[model samples]
Target: MPCVLTPDPTAQETPARPTSTSTSLRDRSSAMLREHLRPTIQFLLVGGVVFLLDTAMYNLLVFWSPSHGWGTGLMHGTPLTAKVLTIAVASCLTYLGNRLWTFGDRPRPGTTRSIMLFILVNLIAAGLQLSCLGFSRYVLGLDSVLADNISGTLIGQVVSTSFRYVTYGRLVFPKH
Candidate 1:
């Protein structure tokens, strides 16, 4: 028979026992998954804010490009450069905000590397986005500024988000 004997009501109260797999590997992994989710949500929220800013800037640039005499040129320089510049600036702001708040607990490899690596990843993605945007702008005759921004912004972010998540998951957050 199973031992079911001793009530100790008169003795000092004992702590409640952990009835689940709280001390097991599955529980540990589940906890890690839970922790990772918060950062993922933060990345999305933060990235969304940055995406809005990029779209607004793209539209603004297109709107004023003619007046400032910069939009008429080809992809190598002119408006292409402007688009990249604007995205870079916005990314700079994002990095700061994300490092301090969003992925604050993540293990970034110090300021300089973190800044360079993060921006490098973003810029590479930006380049892809801009390339597509430029194509849409000139080749596809997507003359409308809003349409161009929407396509480039959405497409570029989706592509970059894949790589960015890898970086954030492995490098930024580490196994902590």
Candidate 2:
């Protein structure tokens, strides 16, 4: 005990290290991606339902009406008429789905206001689809049923759905 001294055990213990920058950055990136993707995923899920309803209604009105001899005059098995009716019905379904699921967490507006805004957004989207159909049927002279589906249902829907998703998120269900 004359000269030798023992080291304090506490002095040798190291403090816990803070998270590395790389780790923190990675975590932040992952969190941001998840936050962004969640709404998009929800929208697509709702859209799938809307699309099924829309396609089914469209086919029924266009093909079934002719066979069943249901419609008359302008309401008959015209592509425009079928599209209008199917899209109207689909828009209603879309509104319900988006309100209940897609933007459910956002603050809900008054029912009337919400519906009006939703309808307005859909009108713009519908216009886009209609334009595609008109161009294909009239301008491009590709009036076949296949052409109508390609131009209006496939191409136009892709574009309009993108526009609708952005507008609905920003305008209809804005963050507070």
Candidate 3:
């Protein structure tokens, strides 16, 4: 047989790579990382949405509460029930957004299982937050009410939210 006349080797090399034998090798290395990274970025974006929504609602409530008589001076401290209620509303908003958009694209076994895992993972986070709140208020003796709220809600929320993100990404969203 005659030797094949070919185009440029370098051009062929790069373009051929698309359907290439080497693609599997490159893909093999990247498969795990891509699987891991995609959900992470998605979750972070969802978290951003939730944060903005939650913060806006919370601030609005605070601003309006004064008209209803719970102003700064009248409000010596935010009650736990109020805090919990705010979080509960925010959490519902987050869950709805997350379920509809964030992890919605991923293949799930079923809504029940997915929701169970989602709630369980987040409950751990919620517990961590409450525990932190208890610690800061009762154990650490943080006198300034605002300071205690920051230490507890802000710090604890960060930690637990991290846990929620990882667990939901890896476990709740099953591979298709």
Candidate 4:
């Protein structure tokens, strides 16, 4: 008679496929990420447009020398004023874009309260930008356009944008 091997009953077995629970958990995590990421992406796109607009407006107000004009800018010798004006306009655009697209799915709060909070948050963000600009202009005494752009546009914006992103989601557009 030919010898036959017996099956071992004590062997450990590895799963050939993922369990349904694990797969469902992964799917849920992916969906949550997409939901959050979509708004962030939209916010950044809107911010990009607003940034370009703000840059153009600021440059025009601070550096533009018209053919028939003798001044270096419409707001010559007043960089701070120009920055304020540009920010004001950009704030309006930012509000509309965030409301209509970025946080569109969020529940709407009272219009008056929401607008007030939005303004307050923007004021704080603007203060961050202004502080950088002022430091570059007054403290550091760097008055050149290059210095202004580096401090106000680049550095300042980085700080302010970070603040705005966090505050806008929490205060202005609560998920609840």
Candidate 5:
């Protein structure tokens, strides 16, 4: 007896509606999860680094600087100045990390528009943080160290970090 092999005719046919099938749905969901998980984890890791750097630098400047130090006098208090400077540094670090690792899959690499959008997002985050600080200090009249830390670092960061993650993915490092 002789044997012959033939290709299945259906093997070459493409599905007209992939999404309507259960298998397709499962596959699509799994793929979506995998795709999002990578960037989400990387973004979180980069965010931790940026947060630590920004907070530590902000505290250093706030505590170490003299009352009338070079940049301290520009703002009425050192908290605002420290936050501004540290956030600037953190923003740069974040941009580099997200560009190189988190959202590296973006079509274009380091365009001026991307950088500007990143900066704009960071500026908005800074404003949200500053508002938290102001509310804690002025509206609530809670100007103690603990209060300030809670308001600015915890509350403000929670808000701004959420915003940053969403916007960075959607605007700064959009998936083509």
Candidate 6:
């Protein structure tokens, strides 16, 4: 008999490749993540710029004095008012940036409706920020520069930014 090799019929087979269904599911998930990620990054970038502006303006309004020449520890005697002013300016810039850049691809229902929803969402977010600041200033009785920045600028921004991101996507610039 001629020498020949034969494969065993009972041998275990290698794992099968993923089916088209699974592959497509994975692709869809990746696409969805990418879709959200770009906007998230853009939103954060816009936020960073606005944050710097807000911090500077707030500090100037609350802490600055002609006698002190900056950081002189003189209180402007109106922390809450300063916070409101800075947040209002920052919110306006945020709206423009988010509408033009962050969520530009999403369709706008109408200019009036979109603006109204944007303002509503921002008002809620601003309330959250103000609450943080107010709690720190009134409840905790911490009114130093460091305290104000930590409570109002840092912590408040974090909470409000999260709220704004979610609401902006769902209400202001919906994917639909």
Which of 2 and 4 is the better model by lDDT?
4
Quality of model 1 by C-alpha lDDT: 0.70
lDDT of 6 at 77: 71
In the range 44-125, model 6's lDDT, one tens digit per residue, is 9999999999999888888787776766433457787888888889999999999999988888769799999988998899
Model 1, span 71-92: residue lDDT tens: 4323323556667877887778
lDDT of 4 by residue, 129-149 (tens): 999999999999987778888
The estimated TM-scores of all candidates read 0.68, 0.76, 0.65, 0.83, 0.77, 0.86
Candidate 2 lowest-lDDT run of ten: 68-77
Per-residue alpha-carbon lDDT of candidate 5 for residues 123-168, written as tens digits (9 for 90 to 100)? 9999999899889878988755567668887788888999999999
Which segments of model 3 are wrong by more than 4 Å? 1-29, 56-64, 68-78, 143-149
Ranked by TM-score, the better of candidates 4 and 5 is 4
Clashing pairs in 5: none
Candidate 4 residue pairs in backbone clash: none
Ranking by TM-score: 6, 4, 5, 2, 1, 3
Ranking by lDDT: 6, 4, 5, 2, 1, 3
* Model 2 lDDT per residue over 48-126, tens place: 8888787667655554545455333233336777787888988888888888888899887576777888889999999
Model 4 worst lDDT window (10 residues): 67-76
Candidate 1, superposed: residue stretches over 4 Å from native: 1-29, 64-78, 107-109, 172-176
**Candidate number achieving the greatest TM-score relative to the actual structure:** 6
CA lDDT of 11 in candidate 3? 70
Once fitted onto the true fold, the runs of candidate 4 whose alpha carbons sit more than 4 angstroms away are 1-12, 16-32, 68-71
RMSD after CA superposition, every candidate = 7.6, 6.6, 7.6, 4.0, 9.3, 3.6
How much is the lDDT of residue 128 in candidate 1?
77
lDDT of each: 0.70, 0.79, 0.64, 0.89, 0.82, 0.89
